[model samples]
Target: MNSPGVKIHHLDGIKILDLFAGPGGLDVAAHFLGFKSIGIEWDRNACETRYAAGLPTIHADVSVMRESRFAEIPSTVDVLAGGPPCQSFSVAGNGKGRRALETVKKFIHRLVDGEDEARIDEDLRALDDPRTALVLEPLRWLLKAIDTEGRDPYKVIVLEQVPAALPLWEVYAKLLRGGEGRLKGVKYEAECWQLKTEQFGVPQTRTRAVLVARRPGHGAIAPLKATHFPFDLHRGKRNVAQAEMFPAEPATPGGKQRWLSMAEALESASSLENSPVDVSRLRRNGRMEFFVVSNYGSGGDPKNRGQRLSSEPAFTVTGKVSRNKVYKSMAEYEADTSERFTIHESGVLQTFPHNFPWSGNDQAQQVGNAVPPRLGMHVLSWALRGSPPSDDELVAAATWPNTPRTTTAELRDIGCGDQSQCPPGSHKVTRSRRKPAP
Candidate 1:
C-alpha cells in the first residue's frame, strides 16, 4: 500500500488536555484530526519517549498536579482525555479495582456531593489499591472546570480503560447526562460502550471501555460505528456456541473491511506454508502467513499456551508482548522458538505508524498500554463531529508522518521542569483568547 499523503487538519483554537497520556497514542490521532494536544504524564520513561517523538508533554504526576498545580494548565481546554492506569482493574492483574468498584462509585457520588478534596483523598488512600481511585480524577477535573469561576466547562470529554472499567464509564455517562448535583445546570450528551479494536481495523483483539461526553450543542453524541467486521478466533469455521455469539459478516467493497491481520500489518513475515488441518489458514489475500505462540496460556494453563494465526487479529498485546514468539509454520515452532514481534511491529498492530519514534525503557509496555490511535480517531470523530471520520481522515491516520509536521520548536512546553535540562528546540505553546468556531 502507498502513503495517503493527507495533510494534518488543525482545528484552530481547539485544544486537548490528556492525563496519564502514555507515549502519545491518542495525541497522535488528535493531531491527525487537526486538534492541538498537551499530554500530562508522570512516567519519566514514557516522557522520554514522548519527547523523542516530538509529542508535547508535561512530565508530572497527575495526582500531584491536581493538588496545587491545576492552575499551571492552559485555560482554554475544549477536550479532556486520558486513560488512567488500569493494572488494578485489568483481568490479568489482581482484581483490587474490580473488588473496589462499589467503593469507587461512592467516591464519584462524593465528588458530585461537593466533598472536600482532602476528605476524598483520605478515603481514597484507604482503598486496597490506590490506583483504583485514579479513575475518578477525570470526574474531578471535569467538575472543577464546570464549577470554577471564569472557567468554561470542557466542551468535550473522552476517556478509555480496560473493559472492566465499562461500569465506571457508565457511571460517568449517567452523571454527565443527568446533570446531578453540581452537574445540575450543565448540559452534556454522553455515551459509553465497549469498543473492540479489531472492528476498527486495529490488528489486535484488544477491547476497551470508552466514554465520550460533550455539551449538547455540538450534536447528539452517537455510539461509535465500526468500520470493519469483527474477528472470529475460529477463522472461517465456527462451532455452534461461537456461531450463535458471533455471527459471520463478510467484508464488501465500500462497506466495512475485514479485521486487519498481523501478517497484513507487519511486512517482516516469512514465506507462507500450509500448516496442519488443525492450524488456522491464511486469508485469500495471499500474504506471507505466520502464527504466534504466547508466553502465557489460556485458562491459566502454562502447558496449554494460547496460539493465533497471522491471518487472524493478534491476541491482546500486553506489557509482556516481547515474550510472545512468532513462527512461520508449525515445523518452525517445533524446531525452536522463532523471533518475537518487534516493538515497532507491535505498535503497528496497535495502529501506530510503522516508523513511530519509540523511546524509553519498557518500550513494549508503552505500546501495549496505548489507546490504539485509529480507535481514538473513530471515538474522537464521534465525540467532536458526531460522525465517523471521513475516508481521507482515516487514510491520513493510517499514513501518518508522510512527512514530519510538528517540529520540536513548535511545541509549547507546559509544566515541564528545569528549562535548562529540557531537550533541544523546546518552546512554549500559547493560544489566542479567541474561542474556536462551533
Candidate 2:
C-alpha cells in the first residue's frame, strides 16, 4: 500500500535553500524528509518561528542578498525552493488591476537585484513602467549568472505561486535556452500543472500551480499523483487511473485517502478552557453554536450538499479569512458571530504536524499565508532522490519527533501556570499532582 508520508528511501540526503521562506513550512517538510534546509525570510515573525523550530535561517531580504552570496551557498544544494510573495498576482488583491501590476513588476525586479534600478531608470525616461507586461527580468538575471559561472549548482528548481504565474514560465524557459548558439547542448524544459491539495490526501480543497524545471540530461520528473478516497469516488468525483492507484491495506483499502475532521486538526480536545476565551460571549450563540466552531471549510457551491469531500488531503490555503453569520428572530438582536479562524488550526490543516509553532494573529491572514508543510514534503521527497548532503540536510532528513508522553492533566497543569500556553481548545488545571505517601 502507498504510505501517506513520502518514502524515506527515496530521499536520504539532499540540501535545499528556501528563498522567501515564510514561517518555514516548506523547510520543515524538507527536514522531515531527511533533506538539509537553509531558509531565507525577510519577515521577523517568520524568521523567529523558523529559529524556534531549530532550523537554520537567514534574516535578510532576498532582493538585497548579493549574487556573489549565491556563490557562498553550499556547493551541494540539490533544490532551490521558495514561494515569492504573490499578493500582486492573487485574485483578491489589487494585482489584477492596473496600479497593482506596477507593484508586481517592481517586486520582481527587487527580487532579482535588491534595488529597482532598471524600473527607476525607465520611469526617469518614460514616466511610467507599463502595467500590463509581466515583469520577469530578475529571474533572467539569476539564471544567466548561474549559467555564466558554469555552475549548475542546483539539479532542480521548484517555483510555486498562484495560477497567474503561468505566463512567467515562458520567460524562464527562453532565458534558460541562453542566447541561441552561445550555449550549445545546454537546454532546459519545464512542465506546469494545476494541483489540488485535497486530491493529494488533505482535507481542504486548495488548487495551486506548480512549475518544475530540469536541466538537460536529467531523467524524467513525474508529477505527483493523487491518492483518491473511496467516499469521494462514490459520489462520482474524479479518480486516479486504476493502474496508478496504490495497493489496498487494512486501514486504507483501495488506496482510499484518509479522512480528518476539524476536531482532529484541533487535537480532538473538548473545550478551550483556561485559554482566556470569552465564555459569556460563546454561550450567547445558542445550542448549535457549541458545535459551530471555526474550521477550514469548503468554498464550493453551498447548494451542492451531496458532493463527496476528500478530507485526507488539504486544500490550497489562501489569504482570505472566513466570515461567520448567524440568523435570529425579528424580536432579538442579530449577532455577527464571525470570529476569525485560529492560526493553530490553519497551521495544522496546512499539514505542519502538531508541534509546529506559529506566532501572530489567529486569523486566516497568517495561517493561509503559509505553505502546507505536508505538501511541501511531498514535492521535496521527489526532488531529493539523489543528491549530496549539507548541514541543512540534518533537519530535512529527520523523522517526526516522538509524540508527547505527558497525560492530559499534566499538560493542562503546565499550561495553567503559563498564561500563553497550550494548544487551542485545551484547558488549564488549578492544582498540582499530589505525591503518594511513602
- Candidate 2 lDDT over residue span 300-414, tens digit each: 5444312211122233455543432222222232343333434454565666654454553333555677776755766666555533223254233222343232322232222
Off by over 4 Å in 2: 1-14, 97-150, 170-185, 229-254, 258-261, 267-316, 319-340, 360-364, 386-438
Off by over 4 Å in 1: 1-14, 235-254, 268-287, 297-302, 399-415, 419-438
Model 1 has an lDDT value of 0.75
RMSD of 1: 10.6
- Residue by residue across 1-438, what tens digits does model 1's lDDT show? 111221122212438999999988889888888887878887656776776666767777786676566775667577999999999999988899999898899989889877787888888899998899999999988887777778888989999999999999988888888887877578688888998999887888988999998888766776777877786665456333222343234435557777777776665222222211112233223445677888653555657788777657788888888988878777777897587777877777788866677876889999888888999988887887777778788666644452243443233233254443333444344666988889
User: Ten residues in a row with the worst lDDT in model 2?
Assistant: 305-314
* Best-matching candidate per TM-score: 1
